[model samples]
Target chain A: MARSPATSLLPGITIILAGAAIGAGALTYPLGSVFRPGPGFFPLGLAGLLMATGLGVVIEARGSDAAPPEPFAWGALAGVVLSILAFGLTVEHIGYIPATLLLFAICAVFERFRDWKRLALTAAIISALGTAVFLWGLGLPLAAFGGA
Target chain B: MDLLAGFQTGLATALTWHTLMYCFIGVTIGTFVGVLPGIGALAAISLALPLTYYLDPTDALIMLAGIFYGAQYGGSTASILLNLPGTATAAITCLDGYPMAQQGKAPLAIFVTAINSFVGSSIAIILVMGFAPAIAEFALEFGAPEYFSVMLLGLVAASTLTIGSPFKALSMVVFGLLLGMVGTDVNTGQFRYTFGLFELADGFSIVAVAMGLFGVAEIISNIGQPQSVIRDVGRIRMADMLPTRAEWRQIVRPTLRGAGIGSFVGALPGTGPGIASLMAYATEKRISKTPERFGHGALEGISAPEAANNASVQSAFIPMLSLGIPGDAVVAVLMGAMILHGITPGPNLINSEPQMFWGLIMSFWIGNLMLLVLNIPLIGMWVKLLSLPYNLLYPAILVFVCVGVYSADNNVFDIFVVLGFGVLGTLMRRYGFPATPVLLGFILGPLLEEHFRRAMLLSRGDATVFFTNPISAVFMGLSVLFLASVFLPGLRARLLRQKPGAVAED
Candidate 1:
């Protein structure tokens, strides 16, 4: 569970970059006078604070005890991201039912549950329930199987 | 208004069929999620947030609040039965709850915790009635500078009080503020960081952010993890639930003390039930004559933390109701719900919206009573629910999250935002950064900036106004004190070697 020193500093480094990026973006807007501060004033101040705290973290992590995080679930991450993406991409074009089925199938593939028959049955049941609840009951603007 | 009038208004609202129906739905969902191991109250609330969009604001709030405190009552079931915590706040309940179950005293442990929870919440509700309006009245005189300073203290206190690196936590708050700044700037009507996306003008939907951080992120992390199966504890009969006379004596003092500690901690701007329960458990062990019996079926162990957690959950509403400042992340979402419903919660909330305020308070009693009934008679149902596999639950959760966010604005762009944040939240969790403060920061960021700018304008750019105003100065001083507490401990540890005789206290 012991973490490498370089890995332990990753969070601080990430925060530093985020702050710098935000601060640079803030400079494009008006800075204005202190009496009448512009839109950029608060963000610029927050950027500086963020970067400073990030630096503090970096300093504190030096020679400090560290433990590695749990193993990243790449497959799970992909499954979830893609499933949601599929729903977003298809719900309007292919409609809610197909989109939902696609989502459930993608999740099943990544989850390593190979029982397609059962997956389809559950997917159909879910699609029917979602269509009933979100479409008919709630009157969301979406068709059942065709494009909305 | 006086307490009696307030209760009457509350009862009038809470007793309505519409409010009661929603309250029942809310507590039912709350207990269901609370009995499950992986899905916490935060995720459950976010998922349910969309459905309440069409309801009355009062009903919506009653339901959301029910989910929160109801989870506290139901969380102990998993801890006592399976040694697994149903919610993060219930983690302390596992200490003696599991041991008691192993000792064939599971029914007694469960019964005592339910009773203690009821007692704890009753006391906190009394305090809420007595304190909220007074605090709100006192806060009515707050000017822009005072508001800015108090909010600064809340952000600082919230970030520093958490159990992690203060630097990391503070950075997360800053990160959240940055996220909040992405929308159209309200002052000049100029877009600050929309990046040319038309939808970004309104900024990220709070529902999207909340669901991604708490719901979708949780689902992603929970996937591929091995889950423990629940073992049969047989039927819990009514006869086995009664505690012996000695056990009853042991429960009374601990429950009262735990309620006291919980109310105090819960009323603070940045703490919540998790800390309250932990403190209650530690205090009970410290004061016990047989301290060694702790974590080994000690009757005092389960009762104190259970009472403390429930009491804290109820009392956490105090800050939100009085100052419009949420005490924790879950409450932040509840606050966001209020904003979405076009209701601003603050000093004027009680004065302006007496029915909404009092109705929400009264609903807590009804909700707690419903939970007692559900947990006792329907206990076996939840135990059976524990055996439901995560594989089936997660995909459904994913679908609900996607549909829920999309339905909020009827826009597909928000779904992508949820995806991006879901990934970001997962990385943040893995990198030792706390996510709760990020949410608190996001919700408070716009309000914070608005107050800051107004305070500056009123003072004619005199930054010292924050320090010169008495009320504002006290809050600023408190913020500094909180910040110093974070850094001083580390500095002291570096400066002096630890002596055997000197014990470090939290």
Candidate 2:
């Protein structure tokens, strides 16, 4: 669990900044009296608590044997993120089937065994099953080929 | 309602063809995911949430609860056969179960776990049937102050009791609370943190957030990791599965003790089956005269914790049903499902929805019996499922996640919400923040705040209203004690230092 001091402190700083952002946004709302709390009351309290915990994290990190964080799996992250994004951006526009195939195409980048023919077959099967189950069977108002 | 009447209603509700069919579907899906390594009960429940939009609320709840306890049964199959736990709660089973499997006693180990799981769940179900209504009756006297204090205790216990840096978990809880504040305020008609988007008015979709955190994030982490190879499970005759008289005698006492521990722990406000199983395992080890025999295939090792985990999963429903408070993240998602179905799960729920409550309880008995059949006679089928390639499985899961998120509101924006949180969840995983606490805090935040504000309004802004109420005061004191348990080294060492890194989300 050993790590350099800077790496150990990174999480604490990140939390603090997040807390600050929450607090700043909360400040825009009216702070009513405790007798009649307003919209911002709970969020402001949460933000303060968040920042305090962040400080506690910092202190604890310094006192304990902190380990460096694991490196990000950029390939996996990108593949998943891009695939979901493609689906989200085009689902309503292009509809479920095309959007789903696009999702599969984007996700294929992270696969270790990418036989195109097999992949295409699997994707088609998935699309058909998804269409049959979610669209036709459940009667969800999704278009199979185009925008509903 | 009288006991006989409740049973009659439950039997009538559960025996209907559609209800029985959904129960079957739920347990089947539960076993499938539980037999798999990466996908867990939480992720599976979230995926099924959108699909259940059209079902009756009672049926939906029945199916989802089946997935939960069904996963417990499925998890042990992997632990015993492949030495790979199907779920986190089954991790303890690997200690003795794998050793027994290695010794060609796999059939015996599998039999013991399946039977013990049934025993544990049956006991817990009985407890739920007896206690839930009584607890709800007591909770009917609670006001806003009591609700706030108890919820505060839940959030605190969730953060502090989990295995990790308490401060990091606390940060995630508060972060979740902040996320929960992103919609319109009910007290005033003002939009909060909406940034001019109308979709944000109702709040970030709970399904989207849950999927992103548990589902998408889990897939991202599991992807690119080397998949474990499944070994061939040799032929097993039915005769091998039957326990000898001595083995049966050895298991009975441990199973009973485990059920007791699991029911107690699972009924608590912030604990879950993972903790219950670990505590049960430690207790077994401490009391055994031959502790040295434990890891090498002791029947007690496999029996107690399997029973404990299953028992805990069933008993965890007590707090959720009685107080509308979830003890863990999965139950929190289940609570979210109840809310989505237009049925709030609180003190008035059992009285208001007796059919739903009693029927769900009765279904547990039916579900457990079904699982005993599925796990024992059909064990070979699930073992073959273990051989499915992760490359194929994850892509399909990704598709379900996308469709599921979109289907929640027919909004593309929710998918984006899932994506953003997916990245955030990945980063949190890398940084060692526990994700389960976030979900718990997110679900409880709005209710906690509502109760806090209401209590204050009634008390004329008097902050001490929490302490003035006896029920609220007890919970507040427990919250303080939980905090102190983490900060005080002596208490922390005594209470939580039991098998560190063992307790985790189911």
Candidate 3:
């Protein structure tokens, strides 16, 4: 159950990066007038808080005597990331049905699905049912075929 | 007389075909999710949110509410029969429930839980029917300062109740607040955290974040663990599922106590069924003359926490429906669903839309009854599902998450966001950081910020507005006291020592 200092340090880095990005975004908009709050005021304040908290976590973790952190689950992590990317890339071109089928199939691989037929069938059925429900039942403007 | 009339109207609305069908669907889906380990009710509601877009708002809400409570009942089954708790709230059930099953009394444990859940929910429903409007009316007097204080109390309570490193929990809450900052600024016309992404203009989709954190991250966690055999307790016969006279007597006092604790805890902002269940279990053990018998298969141990959890689930709606501030993540998503359908929830909602209010209230009763009936027959089926290979089950979950997120906006951007959140969630879990606080923070973050800003504006930059409002002042005082109690070394040590049952269970 012990966590490594690296585990804490990484999130600190993420917070810093997120804070910088948010702070940069805040600069683009007016901070608001003296009488009224501006669009950027909240974001700027929040970014500062995020950076401070992230830094605090890193410092606290470094000083703690807890167990070292375990290795990250990279395989499952990569599968999730790749599936999402594939979905985003294919959704517009192949449409919802095909894109979802591919996404599901890719995700199934991480779940240890070795049989191609089972994975494909499950993905196809899921895609078809999802399309029918969201598009036909709900009347959402989900494209069926790529052009449509 | 008014309470009777409200019930009569609620019954009329709940009896309709549309409402009944939705209730059935919600309870059925809820039971499945509840029985399955790792997939919580929050994910179930978030996944179902898109499907409700086509239904009438009342029916949709009724269905969602059914799922919320139904999950509470269903979660106990796995906890009692197996070592695994289907949800965190059910974790307490496992302390004694699994021992009961090991002693060949799984059905008895299930029976006790069922009755307890029924009693807990029934009491809460009666209170809601009788007192919701009165509470709503009283809440109408609250100004921005009061709302801000309430939100502040909620964040603090959520942080304290969450399991794991407090620092991580606080960080997650802050992260949630930052996430809430995405999309258009309500007071100003400009967007704050969109980062050139038009898709995020409406804010990071609640469905995306919820599903990613609960659903997709769960799948990732499961993948890392070695696949183990899903244990099946023999067919649960009706005879075995009925509680004996001795068992009933053992559970009665605990059930009543659980109901009382659950109702009050559930009414508090941020604390919900999860905290209530833990507290109820610990309290029951403390009051028992023979505390030594607790983890060794005591029916009261199973009954008190299970009953309290379900009761708290029903009562948690009080703050959400009456005050318009969701108490937890599930309720937060429920609030989002309501807003998405153009139904504004608040003090005036009951007055403005009595049918909607009454229909939702009525549907909750029907949903609870439906869940009880649906769960009994399905217990066998769920036990059978435990035998299914994780490989097959995990893929189906991913498909559900993928399709569920895609349907939210018909945009691929959400799909990407879900993946990003999935990674974030997995990392959070690995580091022992609780995800629920993040959810609470995300849902309440904007409301907090808005109210805080407004309070400041009205006070002309003076922070004393928070202290000036009587209601807000009282809550802030309590918040400071609670924080001190939690952080002060002597007080923390004393509180920890007093809750010996919780420590043992942990």
Candidate 4:
């Protein structure tokens, strides 16, 4: 039996709703703060609204006559995610230049950069320019190679 | 005399060597990014914001404002030369701009667009100088309830933005509001959805969300398209780009009309430059002696929207600088930057920091002049840039996005947040959900929450205070009217039926 796109989205929607509920419920613990309305009040209200809205979406999706959802572009999505991760993990240790270069190369994989030499040249130029402007000229306290 | 004095002071401040250099740099960079497809003034400003950390606040703002208006001028260059709009505001320009180019009138289109942009922005700047203080004083009357109602109206208008299902747009907005709720609670000092993570304490940065949604998602969507070799306008001299006498005659009236429409729409929070351009284009078409002449490369069509867009960019500042309320995401970011510089933006800003306020306003006129000078000579260079491969461009954009986000707060967590939003943005695009509404929700969500809580507190837990406030009541009425027009089945059906061509256009 094949599942409809709406049905497939149910799990994601449910998770979102669960998160909203958890977010709202956690706020109740600190409802008696000193502020006129306190911090918990807004979060709890927003979280409840969010959960209700998510549930509404789920119900609406189930009833609507919209077409099946398009298949997610997992490759491009994964490439973006990985590039972000590489930049995050390496920015401090390897410095801005190396980390940015790694990200550029990873993102290059999304588009078919058939000419490796051209790609490498472009990446190098970008890294050099970025380093000059953001690091050297701006005098950011970023590590050049690795050590602080 | 006051205007002239303000202008003199502004000129004095703007003429400083450092400020002039930064102005040149700002317009140059703004034009470059604006020429590039998918990059815009907002992205340019975001990337440039960190650099301002080292500069004088007045100079930084002067340069930033230059870039903001410069992008509007540069955006028309792409729309005229290529059918592809560099920014959403330029989308209306593409309807007639491409046709004008095809008619061997590319230079005329570019020239007229630049002139109109200059005129429109000049008029708005004059208005800003004349009325900003008065407007700011008017805005001071607004309380939390009024602000909440205004935001409610904004969100409702944002919902009408999507050409597709209203329900989907509302869902996207709700999702954004929820995302905005992450990190430590502002009032309680307790983490709400950090899930044992310390980095989430600051909440997700607007830079992360904006870069991901506009920049990264755009790259993802454009990845698989077959690459095309850039076309060359061989030996097209710069003089050839200037508008002919007849072209000027056709464009002047439309340009004035566009400016009027832009200033009015831009004063409303949430309806900004993009909407102004669309409205100007539609109004121009409606009023034209020959409506059918519009898409066939009419010079008026290009001029009107271009004028409106530039005017809107300038007029949008009225709300931000006056009320300390931003009309859109770009202005919101600007407000954040101002606050970071220890400058409070509100009613007292004009009186307290007359130099900053008047100097900034005066710099806009200078910026427009600077843009005209900077844009004309560089048209050839931008045309050359259009030849670069998209594959090469995406990587550079990715790298820039990473660097820009990373530099903000020097936190790696921002990168992950950007990535998450990028995927979500890509999905939203594919599903025909409007992204601007999400931005509106994120910006206005906290304000709405604060106001709701405040109103509740003031009324001793009763909700009637929100209704009792006269200003709030009016805004709430407008919100209801907007929502009713959108959601009521009979009205929706009638409106949808009337705009059958809208679906085809979308």
lDDT of 1 by residue, B1-506 (tens): 99999999999999999999999999999989998977889988998888889889999999999999888877899899888788878988998999999998899999999999999999999999989999999999999998988888888988877666789888988888888888999999879889999999998899999988878888888886887867988779899999999899989999999999999988886677888888888889989999999999999999998999899889999889999888788899999999999998899999999999999999999999988888898889989998877877788788889889888998999889999989988887777777888888899899999999998998999999999999999999999988887779866344222211211010
Q: Distance (Å) between predicted and true CA of B351, model 3?
A: 1.6
The TM-score of candidate 4 is 0.90
Estimate the lDDT of model 4.
0.74
Report, for every candidate in turn, its global Cα lDDT versus the true structure. 0.87, 0.89, 0.78, 0.74
Structural RMSD, model 4: 3.4
Which has the higher lDDT value, candidate number 2 or candidate number 3? 2
Residue A4's lDDT in candidate 2: 74
How high is the lDDT of residue B325 in model 2?
Answer: 89
* lDDT at residue B255 of model 2 (Cα atoms): 99
Tens digits of per-residue lDDT, candidate 1, A1-148, equal 7777888888788888889999998998888778988999999999999999999899888858876666788999999999999999999999988898899889998986556776777787888899999999888888888898
- The alpha-carbon lDDT assigned to residue A39 of candidate 2 equals 92
**DockQ for each numbered candidate:** 0.78, 0.81, 0.53, 0.46
Q: How would you class the docking of model 1?
A: medium
Instruction: Give the runs in model 4 whose Cα sits over 4 Å from its true position.
Output: A1-23, A32-36, A55-72, B1-9, B238-244, B489-506
Reference contacts preserved by each model: 0.72, 0.85, 0.54, 0.47
Q: lDDT tens string, model 4, B1-506? A: 26677677778887778888887787778787777775677777866776787889988888887777777777788888877666667777888988988888887778788889999998787777767778777767887778777767767766654456665566666656666667777666777667778887767777788777766777776675566446665554678876667866877899999998888777676666877887788888888889988899988888888888888888889877886667666776677578658886877787677778877887788778988877777788898887787767777778778777777777777888888888877877765566666665776566577677776766677666667889888888987886677557677776545223232111
Q: Which is superior by lDDT, 2 or 4? A: 2
Clash pairs detected, candidate 3 = A3-A69, A4-A69, A32-A38
| Top DockQ hit | 2
